[model samples]
Target: MKVLVTGAAGFIGFYVSKVLLNKGHDVVGLDNINGYYDVNLKYARLHELGINKEAASNYNNVCKSTYSSHFTFVKMNLEDRSELPKLFETETFDVVCNLAAQAGVRYSLENPETYVDSNMVGFLNILECCRNYGVKHLVYASSSSVYGLNKKIPFSTDDAVDHPISLYAATKKSNELMAYTYSHLFKFPTTGLRFFTVYGPWGRPDMAMFLFTDAILKNQSIKVFNHGNMERDFTYIDDIVEGVVRIIEKPTTERVQNNELYKLYNIGNNNSVKLLDFIKEIETNLKMEAKKDMLPMQPGDVERTWANVDALIKDYGYRPNTSIKEGVKRFIDWFKMYYT
Candidate 1:
């Protein structure tokens, strides 16, 4: 199958593209490589996929990977209505895994327009392309943050996500709605996977796992938000990629829940680990204790998040079994190797 993986330079997107290429699928990776975090890290991810740094950093140019002949990459934004559609028309992608977006809840508070442009407007373009082209399945990245301030113990798909505290979450919720509409009107098959706190090697620098690990190694103080009173269903990277691959491979055969080929699932490790405990795991792996600076919860932040992945399990036999200890160890191992 020919697949178009948006945000292929991203952590999840990078891993997903590699997996698909190994499975003998033709993959075209797309990313603007914005300076949201670190462009070097993004470029390094592309480098791993055999893409040249010079070619990947350029705009609108397609670079064939030196790593895998089956993988090609384009440096472009999702909001580029002109270039995006041209690629779609040329590739005629069978499956589109739309993982591209301006991620980071706290960052959204500072830069709201970025969220709207990428997550909202950009998503509309993807829907338009999928509808226009003969794309079979459209699998997108949603967030557990959409659950917001809900007191529900285990956040489920049935739970009301009407109250998103952060602009990032709001845009994500908006994407789900937009997907539903496109499916209803044009009969486009779409799946939105509400990912929890995904962590592993090649992870984002802004995330808790990466932040804590970096600070600890440098003997710097790590910020513990909510005064060490937070819990997250931290799913491993491999498990998340597996679930996404399964959904992409198996297109929605029938209408789901009165909706025309629209499906949403919580792709997460069903277990929520306490923040302090998660920190302890990182400390254990690095063989060093982190200098902690307990802080109050920042605005646009939730106390806890726990995903009810029963639907994913039932539908796709999805099992996110990587423990916190193992995941942290693997990340630290990669961090040491990469940094050194």
Candidate 2:
């Protein structure tokens, strides 16, 4: 199948695109390559996908991959009104995996408009294109952050996510609502996967795993948020890509719930690991103790997140079995190679 993966240069998006290409699917990757964290990292991801950095950096131009003939990269933003529609009309994609968004819970506190433009307005554009172009399946990324400050031990898709702690989460929840409306009205299948704290090789620098590793390696002090009182369902990248690939192939039409073509599931490791334990794994892998700066929890941060992926397991036989120790070791190996 021909697939369009938005934010193809992104952490999850990059891995997802590579998996799709390996499966012999014709893939087109799109990203604006914004300077949110490091544009070089984004370019490096694209380069790994066989896209020329010079060609991919140019806006609105599509570059064929030197790595795989089945893969292509486009330098485009989701909010582009004119260009986005034209690309959709021209390509006529069968499935669209909308992974692009302005991510980060804490960053939303400072740059709220970026969330509005990318997550909300940009998602609307994706919905419209899917509706107009006769696309079959629309698989988009959602976040566990939508669970907000709920005291629920293991977050289920059935749990109430009405109260999002941050604008970033709010926009993700809004994406689900928008997709459901499109699914109900247009009769197109839309699936939203609520991802947990996904970490592995090529992970984002802003995330805990990368930050902690970088700080430790550089001999800088690492901030232990909430004074080492936090837990996360840190799902491995390979498991996430597998679950996503399965979901992409089996759209909502195959597994209809509540008579709606829209469905949601938590794509995460069911086991939640403590924050300090996670940090310890990094220290073990790097063989260096971190200078710890214990601090209060920042705003828009949750104390714990544990995913109940029973729905995903029941339907898709999705099981995330990667342990934190193994996952951290792999990440540290990649970090050392990439940064050294």
Candidate 3:
């Protein structure tokens, strides 16, 4: 199948595109290649997928990766409706996996408009494109942060996520609701995946794993929010990509035994680890202890997040198998090598 993967230069999207290419699927990847963290990292990811620095950084037309003839990339933002439709008209994508978004949970406190434009408005455009282009299946990213300050031990898709602690979470929750509406109205099969704290090699610098590792290696102090009391269901990159590929391969059309096509699931390890323990793993991996700075939890931060991925397992055999210790070691190894 010819698939259009938005945010193809992103952490998850990069791996997902490579997996699709390996599976012999024609993948036309899309990203604006914005300076969110480091454009170099994004380009490096594309480079791994056979897209060189010049091609991935090119902003005009789509570049076919020299790595895989099956993979092509467009440097376009989802908010740009004009250029967006042109790509849709040209590619005529059969499946769409939307992973692009303004993705910092804490940053949303400072720049709410970014979330509004990228997550909300940008998502509307993707839905519009899929609706207009006769796309079969649309799988988009949601977040476990949508659970907010709920005291629930294991947050389930069945749980009410009406109260989101941050604008970022609210936008993700809104994406799920909007997708459901489009699915019902246009018969568009959409799946909203509520991802847990995903970490692994080539991960985002904004993420705790990367932040902690970098701080430790540089001998700088790392802030421990919520005073080391927080817990997260940190799913690994390979597992998250695997779940995504499996879901994309088996479209919602096949899962619909009756008439329902829209589905939402929490994609997580189903194992929550304390922030202190997670830091310890980093220390062990780098063989240096983190310079600790204990602080109160920031606004828009949750004390804990544990995803109940039973719905995902029941529906699509979703299983996340990487332990934080193993995952962090791999990340530290990558971080040292990449930075050096």
Query: Per-residue CA lDDT of candidate 3, range 247-310, in tens?
Result: 8999565655565778888889999899899988888888898899999989999988898888
TM-score of each: 0.98, 0.98, 0.98
Error of 2 at 65 (Å): 0.6
TM-score of 3: 0.98
Candidate 1 displacement at residue 178 in angstroms? 0.3
RMSD per prediction, one decimal? 1.3, 1.2, 1.1
lDDT of 2 by residue, 80-114 (tens): 99999999998889999999999999999999999
Worst 10 residues of 2 by lDDT: 251-260
Give candidate 2 misplaced runs (Cα > 4 Å).
251-258
Q: List residue ranges in candidate 3 displaced over 4 A.
A: none
Clashes per candidate, residues 3 or more apart or on different chains:
1, 0, 0
Model 3 scores a C-alpha lDDT of 0.89
Q: Across residues 166-232, which tens digit of lDDT does each residue of candidate 1 receive? A: 9999999999999999888888789999999999999999999999999998999999998999998
